[model samples]
Target: MFPIFNIHNVLLLVLFIISALIFDNFRHVNLEVIKSFLLENIQYIFIFVCQFILWYKTGKTEKAISALSDDIYKLHKTFQTETEKKEKAISALSDDIYRTLETEIKKIKTDILTLGETFKTDAKKAEKDISIFKDDVSKMCETSQNETKKIEKEIKNEIKQIRETFQIKIKTIEKYISILNVNINQIRETFQTGTKKFEKDISALKNDISKIRESGQKHSSQAGSNLSLTTNRISTIQNSGYSDTETLRSDFIALVDQRSKRETRGYFTPMLHALTEEISLSFS
Candidate 1:
């Protein structure tokens, strides 16, 4: 009973206890009275205490689980962001490389076209020289033939060098492409592995949550059943106490009546018995 009072209300608690005793003339309370009071009040107190404890524990567990889930979610989101950034960077690099290759290819084409135009101009100049030196037939013909052969050799050398340069550029582009493919494959593998790991972690978290919920429910059901059983026992005991008290009052009244009559006592016995019966009935 004293435990039922809060520390801050100790004065009020003391006053209430004193009043109860004062009104009851300090009845030197019996087990039956205590049991009846507990039967009426203890069930509610027990239920409230149990529910509060369960709610507190469940709340804490859910909070912890929620925090853990948030952390995992944040980590997964960060990973995805990082992966996207890396992919964008790789894409930018590939685009830059492609642009550079295209520029190089365009420069090669321009150089080849300029070389062809120079060869054409040189051939036209040789033809004009041949017409002008028509008077020196044998000498002019030999000189023109030598010049034509020299021009053809120079053109062949230039064409060979251009072809070699183009082949080297092609090889370089192929190497870059191969390297890019390898990098892409590696990135994909890493992403897949990370996805699998996160999935496993999420599954495990879900299982733990399910187990916690099941355990909480089981404990709640057990507590409810135990509380029910206790209430029933208290009710049975209270009823039994009431019947016994009634029987005792009746027996005491009969004994008093018999004794009073035997001793030729006064009219007080009937009135006392009636008052006692009324008080007992009120208590019951």
Candidate 2:
């Protein structure tokens, strides 16, 4: 009743044929024929099953291969994107570092140039100041030399004046000494004249005393004749001699006091020496 071309119908027909053949040949055929036929049928069935399984598995494998390829392509895209971003960041950082270094180098160059100019200016100022200092020192030295010369000239003038004053003092002292010598000689002559006159008066008094003694011895009866008159005359002569001696002493003392007052001033040593010599000569 089924179609013979259909797979189910063919499987049922083959099973029925196998059952009929088993039933018919089971008694007649030997065990060897039965085994041969079963082996042949089993081999054909095994081959058909293997072919069917392989066909279905091949389709599944192809679908899995396509999905795996898609996943690999997506992973490759992500990795490329991440690598590009990292490379860009690294390049930007490198550029910033290069720019900063350039700025720093420029600043350093400018600072060096400024410092060099300042140093040059300072050196020029120092040279000018040193020159001014040298000029001032030279001026001071010249002024000092001129001042010293003026001082020396003043000292020389003072010394000359002092020498002239000393010479004047010496001349004055010489004049005083000469005046003292003349006065001393005059006093000496006057003293000698007074001494000689006193000696003569003393001699006359001695003669008169001898004469009075002789007249008294010879003329005892005429005593009042010239006795009192001779006595008065002798007394008068003695008074005159004493007054002259006092006058001579007073004159000598007054002359010495006058010379001392006039000549001694503050220069007494030489004057005292000359006066001592004159006094010694007068005394001798």
Candidate 3:
């Protein structure tokens, strides 16, 4: 068997022997004679048995004595000694464990304290950052509100001024309309008179031009005999520049006619609108 089984068997044998001895000693409860005889040697036998049993049980010291009193004293001494030794060893072990536990607890406490301090610092920084952010946001909101109010005030003022100016411009346009109505009446009368005069002048000029063209061409064709007329025609064209003067007059009249026609045909509306708009915008 293993050591554990061997040790258990030995313990069992010692217990059996103790049981047998106790039984033998207690048998015949009424025998006073046997009790006295065994009394003198009883301590010895019991000490021997106790020593043997104790040795088998736990390897304790033997309690050898001349008397029961001596045996008891020796057992007491052995018990005190063994108990003291165990107590000393246990005390040492407890002190070691206590010291180790104390060190670990202190280390843990220090680590916890460091973490607490770090957390505190970070919390303070977070609080400060939040406060700053709040302040910045508040300031931005205030500035935005102030700017909005300022812009609103400016816009209101601008709108009021625009309304006033628009009213003034309307009045000014009404005055110009009155003046334009008068001018339009005058222009209508002038157009009637100018139309007749322009038509008469154009008719006269056309007749003159036709006559000159006819005379000039006929002179060129009869170059052999009408040398004098040809000479006069060329001379008139060069000497005083009469042909150039006539062409200039004709071009002027043509320009006038084109202007009149352009106006009559509503081609001058764009110019009239631009002029009126320019006058109206002068207020702004």
Candidate 4:
């Protein structure tokens, strides 16, 4: 058989653990009243103490959750910051592209204007030169069209690249979001568990405090009763002493008066009277 140990602690912790595991935060009404008595106090103190220790662990887990949340938040902010940077770069690139497009258009317009101005100046001579120049113009037009197509292709490719990059970023963000949701769920569970533990501990503490208060009250009442008894005994002694002193005073007064009538009652008699008066005054 197992030897009996610190029964109070054992009972306290055992009851708490059993109750927590069995009830899972369910009510145990009047546990306080039941445990407030000596037997129950001894039983539940261990459970109460254990809960107090777990309270620290619960707080630590909460802190870890908070730290993880901070990390996730920082990751998200970094992603946003990088995205903003990419967008700004794309904006600048787009502006440059638009400016190049405008320049090309201006070049084409100037070329067309030059050909028109020359064509009207000399008809026959111009026709002969125009025939020769038409070949050059056709070649230039072909080259220009090819260059424009190439630029358009390049722009389309760049846009496709940007779209692909954006898609990848979106996927990453979703991944981070998924992780965040999981962490939050875990933290929530921890909080729920921790809350129940706290309740369990609080219930046990209330029981202990109640018992201690009852003990204090009992002790105080006993002490007061004892003090009253002592006071009464003291008063009895004082009364008895007073009565005895009065008897002694009566006898002494009778003896003095008799002595005064019998012979010489001297100045010492007054001294004795004064001494009695002083003694009474000293007591007062």
Best candidate (score: lDDT): 2
lDDT of each residue in 56-133, candidate 1, tens digit only: 676668769988999999999999999999999999999999999999999999999999999999999999998877
lDDT (0-100) at residue 277 of candidate 3?
48
lDDT of each: 0.67, 0.74, 0.64, 0.65
Clashes of each: 0, 0, 0, 8
Per-residue alpha-carbon lDDT of candidate 4 for residues 101-164, written as tens digits (9 for 90 to 100): 9999999999999988887776778788889899999999999999999999999999999999
Candidate 2: deviation at residue 227, Å?
5.0
Work out the TM-score per prediction. 0.26, 0.39, 0.29, 0.30
Query: Which order, best to worst by TM-score?
Result: 2, 4, 3, 1
Q: What is the lDDT of residue 242 in candidate 1?
A: 56
Residue 189's lDDT within candidate 3 is 62
Q: How does candidate 2 fare on TM-score?
A: 0.39
Better of 2 and 3 by lDDT: 2
Looking at candidate 4, the ten consecutive residues that score lowest on lDDT are 259-268
Quick one: how many clashes does candidate 3 have? 0
C-alpha lDDT of candidate 4 relative to the true structure = 0.65
Candidate achieving higher lDDT, 2 or 4: 2
Instruction: In candidate 2, list every pair of residues with a backbone clash.
Output: none
- Clash count, predicted structure 4: 8
